[model samples]
Target: MIERDEAAIYVDGLTKTFGSGKNAVTAVEDVSFAVAPGEVIGLLGPNGAGKTTLLKSILGLVLPDEGEVRIQGSDVYDRPQQAYEHVDAMLEGARNDYWRLTVQENLRYFAAIHGQNPAVVADRHKSLLERLDLDKKADTAVRDLSRGMKQKVSLASVLAGDVSVVFLDEPTLGLDVESSLKLQQELVRLTEERGLTLVLSSHNMDVIEEICDRVVIMSGGHIVANDTVEALIADFERQGYRITVRDIDDVVLADLRERFRMTSIEQTNRKTRFEIAADSATFYRLTDVMEHHEIDIDSIETVQPDLAEAFVELTKSSESSMKPNTIEKGDGD
Candidate 1:
């Protein structure tokens, strides 16, 4: 076995089951992957898709029913301390500091407890405060900060440690678009300037599409797809069209629905508009059907493919291939 120290994190055949008998539910099933040094890996999946459990197993926070997980050349299950010292995690709803502490105090305090030098901690505190846009309220107690601001503080504290890897779960939740972009920019800077490796799990497709070097998508407790975002998008092109028509009465609307995949229908006083999805052949068929029925044509426009559509398609595909299964609610994701 090659010790993949060159990789920041590695896993093979990782699985987690919650119970025995008919009530047993597997949260993660036979997941395997590796994160290269300094790479940003996005863990993507819909609700109850096993993404969260996989992350916990990799982080050594959950004991796997079966499999191997290694962090920075150390076996996480065998040498917990050594495996975790180089890692920082910001799981959603987790507190990295006391409520009584101020933003500056939290950073300085956590750093010191981690055995970081006081001088280095001070330097990190100043730099992070400015970069994360928390400088103005550095002295304010964390309990007083808004939810979004507190999340920023949590992310900022991760850097206070001398770790090479960071795990962030829904880092953008509760944030406005402006603050979300700020945090995203900071994440990019960390990877670019400091060669930090990040394992990010989020439902925000925009953040995943923009920041991740590679994506791992899960469904039914299994990894349905794993590849670079660009490749995945290119391979699975979305098929969509928006069309306007004249005199779309119930008969015509029913016919259209029966023949094609109509996502939405909007009817103006005289004209009707529909957003439909189809392959090239079906798209042409739709136009021909309209012409044959003598329905007046207005215009048609193409809808470009994006990550959200790709995610939906992949999950659907995974669901179709799997056997009947029921994952436990809340615990599955």
Candidate 2:
């Protein structure tokens, strides 16, 4: 568990290269970030973008060639036991728990591994099962349960040891919408109630936007943007509006095109519709232009950007910023 004043997880200049020489592929390069206690950090990346390698390296499942990872103020590579004491992960929810065990049994069995007294953790086990909506399946064998139910049982087992940090890798994959929503709600509630830090890796933008305090977007094995969901959207957000005006003459249209960023123009018998990017300053400028032109005003509306747009733009920017490498044979592994 993390003590006061220290980040829950700290990664510094973490670089990992696979293979050797010309065939070597850099999964993660000079990536560094610190996650505070109780913070849910999202890993956003496309395929082959190094998100998995980074997470595994921090968790000690993959060793880094250079750089360091610290957990709870202890260097994970040098003091692994101390650093990993309170870290638990459910990378493959389907395989994390025993197939023959019931939900309650799985939780009890896992908690026992941490030397937690059955009597002491009994109440917590019940609470976890109920909160995860798995109480009804408490007595049901994991093998007999559906995939979602088994995943919930696996999650309960992983968290039953009172770990301070949780890593969930695509926890909602392949689940139905209702099941996914239920799991998401349970995750948020349990993490807040337990004050646990979480690192979530998923392709679901809605889940990331809803749960993560901040997102670290990666592309080409590099961090493109690391900020809160709101801030990221505000930074890369597309701003625009469509205006429908009556008797928008050729001269007025000409002035608008010359003055603003406009697209999607359409004109009917009496009304003209056109789209343009407008901010408060631009809106004021547009009103001034219309007044000067003696043109009748219709309606103007703004379009807000969604998380998907921000993700695309951020990833694209990262891709554009990549520097090509020239391979040279060296005497290093």
Which candidate comes out best when scored by lDDT?
1
Query: lDDT per residue, candidate 1, 105-200, as tens digits?
Result: 888876776678757668768988998899999999999999988988888887877778899999998999998998889889888988999999
For model 1, the local distance difference test gives 0.84
Off by over 4 Å in 1: 1-3, 263-272
Count: clashes, candidate 2: 0
TM-score each candidate.
0.92, 0.77
Candidate 1, residue 304: CA error in Å?
1.7
Off by over 4 Å in 2: 1-5, 92-94, 240-301, 323-333
lDDT value, residue 102 of candidate 1: 89
